[model samples]
Target chain A: MLAIRRTAPDPDGRLTGIEIADRPAPPRPDGWTTVRLKSASVNHSDLAAVRGPGFEPGTHRVLGIDGAGLDEDGNEVIVYPIVSGPGYADPLYDPDLRALSQGLDGTWAEEVHVPRANLIPKPAGLSWDHAACLGTAWLTAYRMLFGRADLKPGETVLVQGAGGGVSTALISLGVAAGLRVWVTSRDPDRGERAVTELGAHAAFSPGARLPEQVDAAMDATGRATFAHSLRSVRTGGRLVTAGAVTGGTTDLDLADLFIRSISLHGSAMGSPTDLRNLARHCATGGARPKIDSTWPLHDAKPGIARALAGDQFGKIVLHCA
Target chain B: MLAIRRTAPDPDGRLTGIEIADRPAPPRPDGWTTVRLKSASVNHSDLAAVRGPGFEPGTHRVLGIDGAGLDEDGNEVIVYPIVSGPGYADPLYDPDLRALSQGLDGTWAEEVHVPRANLIPKPAGLSWDHAACLGTAWLTAYRMLFGRADLKPGETVLVQGAGGGVSTALISLGVAAGLRVWVTSRDPDRGERAVTELGAHAAFSPGARLPEQVDAAMDATGRATFAHSLRSVRTGGRLVTAGAVTGGTTDLDLADLFIRSISLHGSAMGSPTDLRNLARHCATGGARPKIDSTWPLHDAKPGIARALAGDQFGKIVLHCA
Candidate 1:
């Protein structure tokens, strides 16, 4: 089976040992099972782990954070890309896994081993490529919108950044969840794309003030959009963050947060229960993950590169059929 | 009537020049009434107003953040220090008035005028000093503990920096409300005092490891105690903060917060309605504000100095008789 593995943390370039290579089939441990990958999605975490200080310093690291496949018994399933300790029941709080790709060998390969508890039955109508996108980014958006923020139907939500996986996921999922989803993008074209292709009610420039303050603001853009998210939300509203791809340090005005009674929820991927809930939500809402592009297992570099370049919306998946 | 006034900001020196000199009674605005102040409590906000940045460089600024007195028409009332606009009736989107204190005159001295809505009925059995203490710090603590954090009885709570007004309020009120209150302080004696006098379950050094984790943690000490507060809470617990008196910058590990699903609630002084609720809660529970000592109106300098030095446990009150 061919895998994308990094042998060293390259500073000036991408993952050092990037190549199509073969490895022995990994056996499943107790309470864990192997997913024969049919489709695996590429995420920015794959690119960051290759060059950034993600996991340990110098070892072969497998990259990919989400996948859809067949369980050992041949039932279709989505591998929620997290591998954790025996005590890792919540999945999100699992000590060994820092949201899928931080330390664990994630799910962008021919086959991947994951805790059985991380597997959710793929709905009959959902395709493998769509299921693959639900693992990290989409689940994160779902938890941010519904679980952490407790957003209500018809409530307005401001989504900072319109073309990334979570941002695009938020537009679609929020709309399907009955929220009036508005999106922000640095590029007007991307904003237009979000409104046209995704389910966003409207889209604007990064600091373009909305006509009305939203009930909640979903901000994965980090410092680049944090102030706008703070300003965009109505008083007593919430700001939820599941990712900080941009810079992290932002001017935090304590007085503003207090006066408005606004809450900031630092949300990561999600719990096992949330992952299951995400599957159910997407299935019941007839929502599918937006796939930017798909490639065969051997041609994973371009998909990873596109995700690293921040040039695409939705997920870039690698299918291994 | 006598009033304590700050003629200038003195960041490092004693808050002086404000005198209990004779003045005409304060004139009331529409929808406002004059309170003949029988007693006013010295909060750190008062000290901050007198000696810190809240004071204008060249204006005579009245100083006090909490008071109890007789409203016009002879009604015994406690002044809710914050005077909100009519917009506060629907607080969901309105900027809270408590945040407007930087520009508005604060409560202190002999007689003060406030909007009628900021008056809460003072129970006959409660002392003026106790009622005054509930005006700002106690109400802030009450909202954080019960209203915002949504704490349940018998749950464990850790209060960082045990001796301040809000921390002491949390300890006393948390105990009265059936929480297992644990507090942290640098001073061993204050910790011991907190355990013995305030009914805390246990006390530890600022960063001392606890025997067990708590359901919630209240942090006002900021940089000095934030990490420990983050560490002390159980998974899925709440970390509530009202002030950052010591300092605010800390190396915040965002990963830890998201993994544990910890929720951080930043609070300030609460609404007038919440102040009334706090007064009622104290009356029902027979709880009194822990007063370290009371100074006469003329001797308020020393009380202000003590509060500024951060040496007092519980509220330092300045009583005007």
Candidate 2:
């Protein structure tokens, strides 16, 4: 099996950070099954996994959290990465929760093993690449908008950082779900393209005031956009966050929180049910994941470099099979 | 009307900061009515208004937010300090929301004028002091626990800063609602008394690790207890805050937030309905507001000093008739 493995952490900003290696096919643990990967998408978590402390030192680890593949019986499946605890109905409540590439080998390979429960059937209409994107970024955006923020249709939402995988997903999904989707970007070109390509209602420069406050604001670009995200929502509105790419630490004014009656919900990747619902929504609603660029499994360096530089607009995928 | 008024903002620490003045009674605005005061309670917000920035300078503003008095019809009423906009069912959702002492002249006088809608009938079984306590601190605590956190009975909650008015309310309300209430205080005596007198399940020193994580953690002491509050809740739990007496600014680790799936809710003094529910709960549930000490309105200096020093374990009341 051909796998893209992170041999060393990318501390010094080196390009070609990953190496393609011929590895043995993934061994299926009891109750788990091996899937031959058809497509996989890169996420910021994959970049973090490549950048150190996410995996042990001196150990070559396969890197990717989002993938769509086929089981031994030739059934197409979208892999849910979050491994749940026994008897817990919601994986979010599981204390010992671990996600793929965090604690287990992930889906950046020709063959990967995952729990049987983690497999959701990929719809016939959903393409392999779009199904692959559903595992991480799309699912996160889905949960942030629908599951965590609980936004109603016809309400407004602001997506900070319009060019990233999650922001693109939020804009498309929010628009598909009947939300007035606004976005912000550092680059005006990206902001304009976000409206034209991803169906955002409008786009603004970072920190530019919106004409009206939104019911909810999604922030994944943490420190850079945290204050804007907080200010963008209306009173009693929600500020939902999943990741902080620029940095984590941000100043929070407690008075603004209480006086405005804001609810800040912090979400991670999502529950398996959320992934299933996301797949179903994308399949039935005709919403598709935007792909930035794709590279064959043997030559994933350019895709890795593009993702690391954040130079692309959407999910960077690899044709793994 | 005899009122405790702050004649000037206190930029520097000043003792006996407020003056008891013989002033004209508040003129009732259209659609507003006068409430002849019976009892009023001091909150940290009152102290803030006296200090600076919270209130307009040099306006001789009355300095209390929580009060119980008699309406023009001689009906005993608890003043709901948060004024709501017309047609908005939830006052918290009102963009022009302003609480007593923030934008309006507050309670602390022999008589104060308020919107007629801001008065909830004081339950017959409730004491004037306890009813007064409901307008601010107790209501904030009630909303933080019940409305914001949505805590179920039998869930555990940690109240940070055990001696303040809100902490006392949370301890009593949480206990009365069948929650396992834990408290933390800098003073060992206060912590011990919180357990013995306030019916807390346990008490710990500030930042001390609890035996187990709580389902919800309430914080009003901002910088001093913010980190501890974040650390005290279990994954997928809530940290609800209403005020930040110690300081407003705090460092938030965004990674810890999303990874743990914590919800941070900021609740101000609750709605009129919450005040009514709190009064009814205290009346029927046999829960009484803990009054630390009382002073006649003529000699409110010591009470103000005690509250400013954070020396009291419960509400500081001004006996006005």
Candidate 3:
């Protein structure tokens, strides 16, 4: 079986020691079953494993957090990225909580072993590529917008950084849910495209003074956009964040936060339940993930390069067929 | 009648421009009446007017934010510190929202002209000094705990600073509300006193690791304690702030905040309705603000000095008889 693995971590360079090699098929654990991969999306976390601090240091590990596949029964499904033990009140708080690639053989292989419970039935109308997007980034955006922020229809949301997977998902998902979605981008082209192409209500240059503060602001770009996100919200508004791809530590004006009655919530990826709801949301709204490019699993370096160069507008996926 | 006023704006020194001078009593406006102030609490905001930026520059205004007094009809009352125009939904959001000292003659006088609606009935059992405490700092603490944080009883809350008016009030009010309150202090004596005297469940040194994470953390100490407050809460825990006395700007690790699903909420003083409920909470629980020291209105310098020096355990009051 062909597997994409981070053979070694590159602290200072991109694609330091990635291996596209042949390996014996992995055996499934009890209550787990084999799924033949149809498609798997390349995520920032996948890049982080090879380019930054690998989750399991010194050990080579396969590196995909999400995928669409066919179960043993031939049912098409999307693997829930997070792998946690059962009966936990909320899997998010599970002591052993971790994304798919963290502890198990990941989904970026021809055949992968995953918990049966993680196999969510992909909607009949959705394609494998879109289903592949639901397990991580899309699910994160779904939770941050709906479950974490409790944003409602007709309310306004400001999205900081208009180009990333989570940010683009937020704009599209929010728009489909009847939210007034505003986006900010340092690149004028991206900002303009966000309004003209992504169904955003408005778009502005990063940190530009808004006509009026928004009901909430979403930022996954972290330090680069955090200050602007803080300043963009109305009093008693919500600010939600997922990954801080730029920088993590940023200055916060405590008085501005408290005096304005703003609530900032930190969120990571979502629960299996959230992933299921995200699929329903996308299916119901006829919305789909934006795929920047796709490549065969054996030839994924070019797609990875596009993501590393920050040239992709949305997800970069690899097809396993 | 003698009134405590900021006769001149002092940008550098404490009490530098404060005046305990004789002035004619103030007149009431339409829809307003005179309240003969029995007692007034000196707040941090008062010292700020002389030492930092006064809310309204070039205005030699009276300095108090909260007062307990008798209405013209001899009805005992405590003036809600906020004075805003009528018909505005959520006075906190009102454009005309200002504290008693901001745009009007403050309550640190023999007689203050206030809106009829700003008067909350003083409980018969609450002392004049305690009644004075309910209008600003106490009300702010009340709102931070009950209104902003939505902290349920039996949940543990961490108070970042063990002293200061709001911190002390948080301790007392939270304990009375059936919460398990923990406190942190730089001063060992204060930390010890918090547990022995203020009914706090436990105390820790600033930035000291807790035995376990708390459900919520309260911080008004600002830059000095913001990081500790951010680190002390449980996953998805709430961090509520009112005033940032130390400094307003502090570094926030967005990854720590978002990855753990923590919520940080910014809040100012409570609304008039909150003020009324605060008074009732104090009265019903038989809880009262700790009066650190008391002074007559004519000789309020010592009380002011205690607050400015951060030597007081709770509130400083000036009585006008």
| Most accurate candidate by lDDT | 2
Candidate 2: deviation at residue A308, Å?
6.6
Ranking by lDDT: 2, 3, 1
Report the C-alpha lDDT of model 2 over B272-318, residue by residue, as the tens digit.
Answer: 88888989989988889878899999888888888878788678999
RMSD of each: 5.7, 4.3, 4.4
Q: Which pairs of residues clash in candidate 1, taking residues 3 or more apart in a chain or in different chains?
A: none
Candidate 2 vs candidate 3, TM-score winner = 2
> What RMSD value applies to candidate 2?
4.3
Of the true interface contacts, each candidate retains a share of 0.29, 0.82, 0.79
lDDT scores in order? 0.76, 0.86, 0.84
Clashing pairs in 3: A258-B266, A258-B267, A266-B258
Q: After superposition, how far is residue B48 of candidate 1 from its true place, in Å?
A: 4.7
lDDT tens per residue, model 1, B46-163: 6666555655666555678788889888999988776555644333346644431345555667777777777889988788888888877788789889977888998899999777
The model with the greatest DockQ is: 2
Least accurate stretch of 10 residues (summed lDDT) in model 2 chain B?
B8-17
* lDDT (10s digit) by residue, model 3, range B75-154: 99989877766665456756457778777789888988888888889988788989998877788899899987888998
Residue-by-residue lDDT tens digits, candidate 2, A1-321: 789887776675464456788977656678888888999998878877776555477667788888999987899998888887787647877889877777777888998888888888998889998898887778889999998899999999999988777888899899989999999998999999988987899999999989999999999999999999999999999999899889999999988998789999999778778888888888888789877889898898888888888898667889998
